[model samples]
Target: MKLSGCNLPGITVMVFVMLSSSSTSAITNFNVLNFGAIPTGGTDSTDSFLKAWNAACGTADSTFIYVPKGRYLVGPLAFKGQCKSSQIIIRIDGTIVAPLDYGVLGKSNNWFSFEDVSGVSIIGRGTFDAKGPSLWACKASNSNSCPSGATTLSFTNSNNIRINGLTSLNSQMFHIVINGCQNVHLEGVKIIAAGNSPNTDGIHVQLSRNVEILSTSIKTGDDCISIGPGTENLWIEQITCGPGHGISIGSLAKDLKEEGVQNVTVKKTVFSNTQNGLRIKSWARPSNGYVQGVRFIDSVMRNVQNPIMIDQNYCPRNENCPGQVSGIKINDIVYEDIRGTSSTPIAIKFDCSDKNPCTGIKLQNVNLTYLNKAAQSFCSNVVGKAIDLVRPNSCL
Candidate 1:
């Protein structure tokens, strides 16, 4: 610890950030409670935690809400703004279980919800078990009583969030969702899901900015990381992904209009048995959006299907590929220093739409070995390459 200097614009922020050189005081105090002591089995501990937190913090900008050891069985704990930009050490040696019934809320509920807050962290070695099979099965069967479960840990309309060293398993939907948030950091977390598990994505960040996902391991059914619309300045580094879909940006603007993703960087990552190593997906329709300033650098890939895919005609409802193109425009994308063994021979496929084609693309020192055969999409206006394979078909 050394002395630091800074100019203060706001006194509250000075106290909030605590950048003073001479102080030895820890910024936060612990308010510890064990759910096991409460004798609650389920998300009830979570509900109680919220109530206690509300009383403790009371909209005072933030507070450190500490949960010490013990097993807490809870379902879908919603945190709107209890610990905003504060040290929230729900320390390890504890389990937060989502009740057996609260299915993934793709359309409705978020298991762990955050809204309109900043400088918050959910840290330490804990487990968020979304005991989500009973409801998933019912929803899969099209039961009218079943609700949508799109994401397990969903962050909505917030900023400066951090999730570190946690384990999440058995999600009814996407393992983690960062939606409409900014300045988020996820470090040293492990998320697991089955390969055939429907929509079980590892980390899906949408409509956010300034996000960092580093040193995480993800195994899931869907893309390990899916960057969606209105997202910018995202960095993902040092991650071990797969037994799933590789890193992806977009499935952009599935049903919405005016969505754009920009300034994303993925570096020093490892992929194994994934479908696509580095992928960008945009709709086939002519929509009003653009993805710009994207880079994937220094990554290792193994046994991935279509190791690199740029699909503009994403999610075709009916084949014969439509003429109503997506309004989304992609620009200034770069992939550098990538070596990979692709499970499919269509190692690299660019499906840029005939209308509103991709622009300002650069691929340098990329070598791909695909076993699935090759079929290259027509790059009408595409330019630049150290591109190895573009075949979208199989060797068979």
Candidate 2:
């Protein structure tokens, strides 16, 4: 089959010639260096990257855009596609550095973006370095003049994506974001940033489904993994998170059009020196959303504050949140086989919404303790049951 032209924003035309299954298969490799990409790390290579992406997107059959080892400087780049071929792979072994000046990135919220694409795979051990120290310092010092820094990597309105063996460092904002996507798989990824870096979430999933995050190590400022509104069927396992806010599903109900999240399972994760471990938080405002059928199992926490928390009145920075009860509903959640050392006395806190109280919460074999003292559980407007060997004594 000969795939033809498609239109994309900022792209005039895309021509792909895909081969049918019955036909002889051919794979094409487009190297970024061949497109005048300078690996000296001084010159901007954004145009070279765009050229390679365009070539791969326009090619017929399976295509690989290769970035070999070296340091290459680039600004914000977007790979938008409705490619002729379904298979477009980006194999990166080089380091891609973003400009240190946030002003140069202007208005673009992402350092590298893939949008409206399918059957895309980004693999290979590479680094995406967003020189974000200056940006972080500006934000830390209350310099309101700083521009909003960009996420290191983002996928928007894309599907059937696989990202593996990538290292993201010092991201200005979130390290990775999957937004309005489906059937995405991320494995063996690493994210690193300063604990005080503002808004530098490790991985954020929002408005997405059928996402699996496995064997990832994240050390960042904000939540290691944040599941936002409209996320469903998300499976996270074997994640090592530290020096961050830990994993969270939350701050929902800020938007009325937000959709509920369901069927999220996080298992076999470890949190060390994190602010909060295994948290579910929702804003105290009137908005329609719900979270249900969530499970956290076989997780270990060390020196974690708020080891197990459910805060329905989650107002950040004590911003004087409205007194209105949260409209988001929380139900059918389970925390099992969680053993942790808590940094605070209240290791388990369930502060549910006054209007829509959480129900069907189950705790099984949960052991959390503070230094030289048994941890405590605090419950408010929560309905739950404790299974066998529950520690810290459930207060439901």
Candidate 3:
């Protein structure tokens, strides 16, 4: 496969083939715990499961702590460098629920939290239920008095995480979050929060590096993937997004200082009924950060607003926006293999600041068809046209 040419839903089914390579892989120990066979329905084995996992943390390619078919109630499961070399795989065959009133740990509403950990893999075909009714009620009554909710799963200050074949549902906040972590890989994951749910982003990644999300389907109330600050070498492929905002860069960013995001790529992804497509947003103030080397290739956008947007003047909370352009430059963005239908006429908009005009940007081999009409970009003050880019700039 041509790395960048593969389609979503196509590559996900082949995860086992590409992911199971023995080339410098994690160590393995198989400890199968059939939650159904154990006959412990009422008792929560959160600690027992962790004990079994720790005992089998030998260095091997197949270190698996399998949870076979049953509703096993668990508490927050944490992973650190200690479980790093174990190549951990928790094959959840059934549902994993939390104890009552724990509030799914720290999942949704207000700010979510993540403890420090690294080098883990949570791959399973089962469901992780946050069961967030109590938390929801609290939020419905008084947003201020409720305690912070926990996520169903979080990747915190950790690296080399591979999440596959899982249905992460009804998280208190974001379904999946990667924060202060590096070298993360998400494949064949499904995240679905309640419709019109508040702050329920499907996959929110922040302060991370070298992250790859592959063959995932995300449908949430918020952005399918909200890429936050300090991310580098982020690659997304074969993703199906809908019923939310499409792959966004940021909504709130302080400065272009330690907040640089580079080498971002989204390819072979299909977006349906999304708010935006191929979005890059930034705040205009003390100019604390920069976003560079962003690309969206081989993508299809449908019934989306703003199929392409580069908004430099972002902080949209106030009618009269503040902050002068502090020269947070954006460069090297590419939109190619784009075939879509947008509901709106002004489907493609790049509102880069005049002070810091979007430089080194290109739209190649690109054809955007919106409202039964074909469209091409008419940019202003761009460094290069779609064809004159340093990278190959073509539409065919």
Q: Judging by lDDT against the true structure, name the best candidate.
A: 2
TM-scores, all models, native as reference: 0.82, 0.93, 0.79
Candidate number of the best TM-score:
2
Q: Indicate whether candidate 1 or candidate 2 has the larger lDDT.
A: 2
Give per-residue CA lDDT, model 1, range 206-300, as digits (tens): 88878888889998878888888888788888999887888988887566476688778899999998877899887676678788988888888
- Model 2 steric clash pairs: 17-60
Question: Could you give candidate 3's per-residue lDDT for residues 16-79 as a string of tens digits?
Answer: 4434654524434444353222424566676666666655554535465667677766767654
Clashes of each: 30, 1, 27
Distance from true location, Cα of 146 in model 1, Å: 3.3
**Local error of candidate 1 at residue 193 (angstroms):** 0.9
The total of clashing pairs for model 3 equals 27
